[model samples]
Target: MKIIAKNKVAYYDYEILETFEAGISLMGWEVKSIRANKVNLKNSFAYFKDLELYWSNAHISLYMAVKGDEQRTRKLLMHKSELKKIHFKKTTNRLTLIPLSLYWKQGKIKLELALAKGKTKYDKRQSEKAKEEKRKIEKMLKNYS
Candidate 1:
């Protein structure tokens, strides 16, 4: 799988509970833009409407030679069971679905959806501290060896 773009901030700001892969609906120019490596998943999220999934806020730059919608709401295709489960989690568990990455799988574009809960301020601080501690440990080990 060739990853096109990744939402690095999602990892820092959310606690991921699960992940699912879903196919994306794209237009001709949108797909072309992606092939040119012009897509962003940093602030994109998925939502359910009419029992169908739609993704918004993901930016796919307009193709230079083709006039197309730059940031259209793209549909996400998933199995009925998966969609139902995600809807349930969103409603009952209060979890959010964020698009973590966009990649090509066997010539088709696929999105990796992360089932995540937003991190509190303290949780962010704790994660930062843990990362710092790990860095320090690695440095100490390197110097001692």
Candidate 2:
């Protein structure tokens, strides 16, 4: 699978509990744009309205050849049972549904969604410190080798 766009902030800001692979409903022009790697997942999230899931704030740059909105709300295709499960988790557990990455899988575009809880300030700081220490260890190993 080739990743077209990723929401890097999702990992840093949320602790993921579960992940789901979902298909996205896209316009023809949007599909073309995605194939060209003209997509953004930052500030984007999934929400349910009337029991249907929709993607909001995700940006797909318009194809020069087509006329369409760049930031339209797109539908997410998932099974009814799956949707109900997600809805249950979201409403009862207070978890969030975040789009982690957009990628091409077997010639079809797929979205990786995560069930997550927002990280606290202290958690973020701890992660940052761990990252720093990991970097230092890697650098030291590289120098030694």
Candidate 3:
């Protein structure tokens, strides 16, 4: 799949437990905007309202050539079973539905959503420490070799 836009903050703010790929419903202008790589999923999230799943806070810039509303809520297409699974995890496990990335799969736009739990400040600090230590070890090994 060819990626269009990615939400980098999602990885830093939450611990991703599971990921799902789902189709996106977009207008022609929005599709064109995405092709030009003018989309942002950084502050976007998924939610189910009235048995339908929607993505909000995702920005698709105006095509400039096309005229109309630019910031509309986009619909996410997923199987009923998948929707049920996401709902269950959200309600029972206190997990969040975060949009991780947008990509082109077989010419259609798809969204990658993750079941995530927020990380605490201490957790973030420990993760940074672990990463630094691992990097130091890798550098040391490279130098010795």
Could you say which candidate leads in TM-score?
1
RMSD of each: 0.9, 1.5, 1.0
lDDT by residue (58-131, candidate 3, tens digit) is 88899976776666788899999989878988889999999998999988999999999999999988988999
Clashing pairs in 3: none
At residue 92, candidate 2 shows an lDDT of 100
* Model 2, runs deviating above 4 Å: 141-145
lDDT of each: 0.93, 0.94, 0.89
Q: Which 10 successive residues of model 3 have the least lDDT summed?
A: 64-73
Q: Per-residue alpha-carbon lDDT of model 2 for 34-119, expressed as tens digits?
A: 99998999989999999999999998999987777899999999999999999999999999899999999999999999999999
List the lowest-lDDT window of 10 residues for candidate 1: 63-72
- Residues 46-126 of candidate 1: C-alpha lDDT, one tens digit per residue: 999998999999999988777767778999999999999889988899999999999999999999998999999999999
> By the lDDT metric, which is better: model 1 or model 2?
2
The TM-scores of all predictions, comma-separated, are: 0.96, 0.92, 0.96
Ranking by lDDT: 2, 1, 3
- lDDT of candidate model 1 versus the reference: 0.93
Superior candidate under TM-score, 1 versus 3: 1
- Model 1 RMSD vs true structure: 0.9
Rank by TM-score, descending? 1, 3, 2
TM-score result, candidate 2: 0.92
